[model samples]
Target: MARSKKYFNPFKPSAGAEPPRIIGRDQVVLDFVGALEGGVGAPARLMRVTGPRGSGKTVLLTDLGSRAQDIGWNVVNITAGINMLDDLIHELSPDSSVDSLSVAGNAAIASGEAVMKVKHPNLRALMKRCCGKSKGLVITIDEVQDAPIEAMQLIAGSVQHLIREKKDISLVFAGLPMGVMDLINGKALTFLRRAQSEELDFISLIEVRLSFRDGFAVSGLILRDEQLEMMARATAGYAYLIQLIGYYVWRFADLHRARSMEVSDEDVRLGIENAMTRFHEVVHEPAISRVTKGAMEYLVAMAQEGERASTADVAKRMGREPKATSSFRRSLIQREVIQSPVRGYVEFSVPFLREYVLENADELLDRY
Candidate 1:
């Protein structure tokens, strides 16, 4: 019988699986690695690694935590927010009552020794044993924007105290663009300047030259230079995009071997199509629903026009005035459903989200 064929899945990492090998981020790795290696004499002041949503900020933080562990530093990763902080602390601390307050206090104590000095006797007792001679502990926060304001305050105060006491403790906060703004604008801003601010962006040309080939090798695939360019263009050099592409490509290759006993470019093209379909199904559909469901009809209309609609354009489009539309636009911006990509252009940063809204929103677009 003729051999069957295999296909690729572009959305392989959609559910938060790590790429078997990280590619095209050497500089970021080096910078985070330096922090992990304690290049700072004391616990480096609170540092930040910021990027957009779907930019792989969480994965990078997770990777850093793993690296910190390899180097023998105490590491904590939190995403469930301040409510979970106590539990996290408890896990690291031995003498803690089940009482929430007491557990938080104890965890704080345990973490104190590992990264900063402990003030509470409970924490102090734990740290002396846990921290030993280590200079500091590493705490990494993912999706920091989701954290409650109170939690943010408490964490900021904790680190500030550590700094005041001349103890060692360092932090890594990763999140979307606004998360960076949150860190830089509020009380956290003052403390951040005292430490370090490293912006993690897409892979540079130099890094691509040095590391991209090796990364593909590790994943057991081969790509022509033109194919590489296609991926880079499609993904905009976003870290998550790289992994998403790599994963689907690997799956494609594996399937080809299983069925056809061969892999080819047509298989790659099939993978890309499947990936785009999956992207529309898995991510874009739900995002569009949540954003438009509660929004006013006019706002949904504005979103469909690519968020780049001018105030005048939006009013014209909505059969209203620029003056009336301003308030509506402001609300969308605040809710983060739409954004001004530059000073003038506005668009949905999330892939296909706006397109979905446009396709479905009646009167959002004029008949053309």
Candidate 2:
């Protein structure tokens, strides 16, 4: 038999990079594809996925677009921005380049220098023309929150008319929950509320475990049942953690290269510690920095309640009545910082956010 070759690190912990194995999102992809195959009138064609940062929204968007492409559909993938409409026009067909002419800025006269002039291609018309060349079309936009309301209006109106015409078009987008909610509630984009909405969150621990098994197997590391479970538990069912912790764990084993590629418990211990540090800097710090002082106070109060806490209890801890704190709760929920999993109870939405708060309480409180 041939020797087993050692594979390069299989985990992808970086933001927006597609992991070798996409766990727990199989159904979402299947649903998008099924809806696309169902043709124009399918309710799921216009879809939006929302989750907190590092929740795999970008990777899912790429996977969805790829699946559509596999079905012979033309895919136009873009990140929503002020120039989203122009970007779409160019992506759909670069040949539909903007008209250019030399113009004067100071006076209404021709200038010696040439200026780039956008013809402002009619996205609706351009989409229709492009559709004629393919079986169907999929436009996947990520970061919908960054998209201007005006740009959203043009795109939504075009898709609305196209759907009315029964064109085989699919519009799928992804963004953080806060931004995605704002977009859907926008007057021009309200119709998206009727579109299929998938909340990308933590993958199941079981799913993460199985993914770890397969991913680590390729790297020639031997992990026992409990060790694997430990790895999965460390991930806390968070999709991004699967990559982060796995990368560190695999890295530890690779560097040691002793004991015949067997990953010892110390490797896992060190891995978790290193991963937590990076996570604190990359994820937690930025997330906390964006919150208002009031929200920070609310978050710290919730953190004192441990992994899950009663909303009333949290309000009391903050020295406020439940009614007085309701606004903070609502805003936090909208911001994807805290989630009310059940009535009257709330918890931090991002994994380890509570710990991050508790550990850095002094610095955070002083800053806020």
Candidate 3:
């Protein structure tokens, strides 16, 4: 009997899962690392990462946190929620004694001959103790827009205090563009307006091709240049689709082969179809359901116009003045549903959204 061959799929399609290689984010990663090295008061120390769904904002945050840890900084990762502040406190100060530092009223507190009145312990002091020998503290919050305003305020206040004290600490927040904007616009988080904002865009085709080639080769499969190009084009620069396409294509190839081998065009086609189906079910449906009526109308008009549509064209199709459609256009852009590539042209930010809208337009328009 022949021995069975071992197979490993390197692509990860789950949310927040680190990819085998992070393509097209090298500059962002480098800037984050440089900020960590730059120490206290670096603008990049406070970062806000925004992108459309499946754009890998969480992955980028996770990778940056890992880089901080590797450089001797203490990292705490948490999702933005009602208990975000409490979670941060617990992560920074695990001991009960740290809680006692939050005494009421004006009480003189002495720490190594440095005396200060205690109103609350504050995150700064806790972080100071926690990062005794470490370079600093890095706190990453995902889905920041979902966090309660009170929690966001508390975090912002605490971070501001820490910054004023000149303690080494950094904060990174990842969320959708509008959500991030909402968080920043909060009354207490005015300081966040100054944060280094990084809006993640689509990955380049060249980079996607390189990722597929290198990723498959390491897994003991060879993808021909044309096959690689096909796969890359199918991904349409969306980070999640890249992994989804790769995962299915790799599996398709593996099932057809008894051992490691090359990926065929047939496998690529099936994989692309499967990936697109998943994309519609997972990304497109929910996004469409949440959009406003006006935004939906704009999207339908754009879908009818093909890949790239002008604002004037969309306005004409809607039978409304261009000025009348500006609000809807802005809303769509803020939602990351569409992007303006230039002054007058707008296109769906995600790949296949146009096709998705077109195929379902009859039903969608009926409901609308």
Comparing 1 and 3 on lDDT, the stronger one: 3
Candidates by TM-score, descending order: 2, 3, 1
**True lDDT of residue 212, candidate 1:** 39
Kindly give the stretch of ten consecutive residues in candidate 1 with the minimal lDDT sum: 101-110
Clashes of 2: 0
A best-first ranking of the candidates according to their lDDT comes to: 3, 2, 1
TM-score of each: 0.75, 0.87, 0.84
Highest TM-score, which number? Answer: 2
With candidate 2 superimposed using the best TM-score fit, by how many Å does residue 106's alpha carbon deviate from the native? 34
By TM-score, the better pick of 2 and 3 is: 2
Q: Write the per-residue lDDT of candidate 1 for residues 97-148, one digit (tens) a residue.
A: 4343322231222133123233333333343334444545667877777766
On a 0 to 100 scale, what is the lDDT of residue 183 in model 2?
A: 78
Candidate 3 global TM-score: 0.84
Give me the displacement of residue 124 in model 1, in angstroms.
7.6
**Candidate 2 Cα deviation (angstroms), residue 74:** 1.2
The digit string of per-residue lDDT tens for model 3 on 212-303 reads 88888886788999999899988989899999999899889888676548788888999999988988888888777777788888899999
